[model samples]
Target: MAREKKYREAVNWKKELRLFPGYLILLIWISFTFVLLGWVLLASFSTTKEIFSNKLLASGLHFENYVKAWINSDVAGIFRNSLVYSIIACSLLIVICAPAAYVLSRFIFPGNKLIQTGFVSAMGVPVVMIVLPLFGIVANLGILNHVLSNGMLLIFLYIGINIPYTTIFLMTFFGNLSRAFEEAAAIDGCPPTKTFWLIMLPMAQPGIITVTIFNFINIWNEYFISLIFANSDQLRPIAVGLYSMINSMKYTGDWAGMFAAVVIVFLPTFILYIFLSEKIIAGVTGGGVKG
Candidate 1:
């Protein structure tokens, strides 16, 4: 028993030693992160004078900062716009990518490898290269002048830009699934489409969730695209709108309000991570990892 205990301890020591570097880096990262976010949160509640003096929240909890930011900056309009864009873009990406991924992963068809390779290649192409010609074409079409058409165009761009990454990600996860599920579904007289819709998609939930969260964050925090496309203040998303507000803040000197705006803008992604962190971990580590 003593020898057995010693062997176990020695093994654990070696394992811990091997992991020490990762643990140390994570600890440092977490510590710095908490300090920064903590300051930001407190600064949001503080007066501009207090923030500069390094005495945050000394004036008591001023919820008014949030109110001022929300109202004065017209955050509600931009927030709603971002929400609409993200929700629509994410839903469409899933609908379009999931089936494409499944078909690519499961079937042996002509051009399958080519299609996969194309998607892989597309992922490497930077958005900057294509934005110019695309923007020029849209301007020629004369639809960018209209609000609904402009919004639809933005959604289309988001969906098109994300398709390769989303498809590849879900394709890998779909590939990880055992053929047993499909086999069993076939034996039960289920069609391939039905089997995929009912069985395979649910099985790929973790990956779907993770990818959706990523797409949501990307679309929500998207700056350059929205800055270029959203010509009207009403159509502007939070990222572009926030930039405009910050620029105005330089003259208005509403530092507290700006911090509050930052917090409000950051809330959605933060809530997403908090709620779905487990799924993200599972999705990242579980990706059809074959033995």
Candidate 2:
């Protein structure tokens, strides 16, 4: 009973009364999220009539909602497209950013700060400002009508827009790494490039995983760029494609089907966070130490 009382006061409301308001707000927010997601999950398996009546799951589980959404609705195509774009873009971002970040963080070359400042400034530029010029170039080049080029164009834009953020993020990770590793590698006759690739890069895995997750989520959910450049139906990613699907579903009145589609779209990021959340926190607050 003494232990139980002590445990009950784990929050120490008497001593931390000032924090009670913040905790209350966080609790409210969590409650709201749980209620919202619960409703969506329930609605996905319910019939349209059940959803309208707020009597979800009254009729047994309707697995066909997912089947219909996945097949008849063409969620599979857009899902595949988003997956491919995100994976390729994330891989390329790491490859390009890792070396650039290593150089920027470790070396004191001429105009290094200027280059970093340029990247930081680039991130501040609104996408709307450049969209028109980008469209004009692509349209004039006549690649927008070609399916293969159109897909490639989307990937290129994703990589271009993301470079600044990726480089900046990884630079923090690389900067946190110990120079002792490099010195030791040099003593052992390892080339700088080999040291970076074989030793330093792997040591920065936490930060890389964290930043890659961010990049993947960004590319996966990107709507405006894909909408502008994905000129064809087949080239569309999940965001724009899901928008069109939902709009069409509005006409069909398939409420359950729409919710099922939403859940499908939400799964990848949800699962990713579920698994790598610890790594993300570690990346943000962690660094290598010198012996």
Candidate 3:
């Protein structure tokens, strides 16, 4: 028994020694991230000159940086644009992808495998490939800068880009769902559509919420598409707006305000990950485990 125990302890000790390098790497990364975020936060409260001069604030913090960014730079409007675009895109993605995933998962039909393969392929395709053609089509339509038209077009583009991945993500969840619920619904004379809406979907809440959170963060931070499609100052989402602000900073020299704007843009995603990280992990892993 003593020999066995010593062998097990030796094995564990070797394992820990093997993982020491990974632990050191993780610690270094965490320390670097903390320092970077702290510096940004501190700089946002310092004056523009102080930021450029590598001097910490000896004077009191300036709240005016936030005010200037919010009002003077139209960060308020840009923030609203991001919120609207993200919410609309995520809502539409769920509405369109959910039923399609359900049908694909539950029903056996012709070309089902082909459709699934197509969605998988779509997820792998880079956005750069389709941007030029999409831009040309939008330009030719003369809907370039109008808020309503641009907003609608952006929503459609977001939906089209996201649907394939969302559908495939949900398909795994749906495939893992037990058919007993459907059988029970059918036995109770519930229609197929009703069964999907009322029974299976409710049970798949975890996966749905996870996917929605991901889509929200993705659409919120999306830059290339928004930059190309909604280039107008009035319609710029936070990502593009911030990029414009960074460019303007060369002339305006409002480094404090720029850092403040970056913090504002980063806060929502940070808050989301902080609060729902466990749920995201569970949702992503649950489908594979359930199947």
lDDT of each: 0.89, 0.89, 0.87
Across 245-271, the per-residue lDDT of candidate 1 in tens digits comes to: 989987999899998999999999999
Provide the lDDT at 102 for model 2.
Answer: 90
lDDT of 3 by residue, 1-291 (tens): 999999999999999999999999999999999999999989988898898889868577988989999999889999998898999899889889999999999899998999988888887788999999999999899888677898899889988888887898888889889999899999999999988888898988877998898888889988888888995788888999999888897687778999999988998898998999997677657643211
Best by TM-score: 2
Candidate 2 lDDT, tens digit per residue, 1-291?
A: 999898779757675797889889999999999999889988999999999988999998998999999999999999999998998889998999989999999999999999999888888888898899999999999999899999999998999899888888888888988999999999999999999999999987877888888888889889889988899999999999999999999999999999999999999998988898887557455532110
Prediction RMSDs, each to the true structure: 3.7, 4.0, 3.8
Q: In model 2, how large is the Cα lDDT of residue 99?
A: 93
Query: TM-scores across all candidates?
Result: 0.88, 0.90, 0.89
Rank by lDDT, descending? 2, 1, 3
Candidate 1 residue pairs in backbone clash? none
Which candidate order results from sorting by TM-score in descending order? 2, 3, 1
Model 2, runs deviating above 4 Å: 1-22, 281-291
Cα lDDT for residue 281, candidate 2: 56
Q: Is candidate 1 or candidate 2 better by TM-score?
A: 2
lDDT of 3: 0.87
